[model samples]
Target: SQQGEEDPQALSIQEGENATMNCSYKTSINNLQWYRQNSGRGLVHLILIRSNEREKHSGRLRVTLDTSKKSSSLLITASRAADTASYFCATDVRARVTETSGSRLTFGEGTQLTVNP
Candidate 1:
């Protein structure tokens, strides 16, 4: 499968600590995106890194992509209790040579993070 697989299926940390999660995927991809889900809520996009992008940052979130290794990592700096959520990595692969609408995203199993106050 072309879906991504996240490492460290679960994490527990106190408030103000940093949380790091890693994801690895099979097959070539057009882009990789990170998302966060709070308990029963739907996923919210955190960052999107194209195949050409090595790294990107948004607020306290940092995402890194290594196409050569087919892997990606997400770092949450100084996490708060509100940062508790499940993080997932999704991959967008090229569907076919003639398709132009973009392929559907395949999501990883996700990493559950618990930030205790």
Candidate 2:
């Protein structure tokens, strides 16, 4: 319920073009993160954009967050076949009163990306 939901659950694209994915959540959040996971593997953290930040960049990846709309988007430019993976958006809900000290990341169903050569 509190987890973020991503759009375009499946995507197939050429190697050189860009790939875009969107995520939306229902509650206030401390931070939002993007992750990439290969088939049968653990997730690799890509970017962490805080609530105060509207946009962020890391290498060929760009992320934009809009707190007013409770939404975020990730863009991968000049994609390669190696970039193919399932991307997940994780959010830390600020409204939650938890005794746990560590981060409580809520992940969505993810958008599966396949970059063709």
Candidate 3:
């Protein structure tokens, strides 16, 4: 099965605010990565946390994982207008060569985040 599914497919916030989103998965994975994509732009890697870890942070981003529950959350603090983008969680699992691209990522549909300045 696919690894992650995020809730609240859309969100809106004012500048200098905080935004939080949750993701749930249904299988064991090697790692999970988050990515952001702005309108008409390519996706940018945000953060990645391995299954053995529980939490990780980068810049204004905070991510937490609960392996037991197969869930994860991303927190963006002191947001800015530039933060407006679509967020997606992708899972990485071990795959054999026949699996195609050899990338084990199964991406979610994504959460559209709009930050107003």
Best TM-score goes to which candidate? 2
Model 1, span 1-117: residue lDDT tens: 537999899999999999999999998988899999999999999999999999999999999999999999999999999999999999986664245566688899999999999
List candidate 1 segments past 4 Å from native. 96-100
Instruction: Single out the weakest 10-residue window by summed lDDT for candidate 2.
Output: 93-102
lDDT of 2 at 83: 97
Compose the digit string of candidate 3's lDDT tens values, residues 1-117: 446898779999999999998888887877889999999889899999988999999999999999999989999999999899999998875553254566658898888999999
Pitting candidate 2 against candidate 3, the one with the higher TM-score is 2
Candidates in order, TM-scores: namely 0.93, 0.94, 0.89
Candidate 3: Cα lDDT at 40? 84
Best by lDDT: 2
lDDT of candidate 3 at residue 2, scale 0 to 100: 48
Residue pairs in collision within model 1: none
Clashing pairs in 2: none
Instruction: Report the poorest 10 consecutive residues by lDDT, candidate 3.
Output: 93-102
Instruction: Write candidate 2's Cα lDDT for 1-117 as tens digits.
Output: 647999989999999999999999988899999999999999999999999999999999999999999999999999999999999999986766467765678999999999999
Score each candidate by Cα lDDT.
0.92, 0.95, 0.88
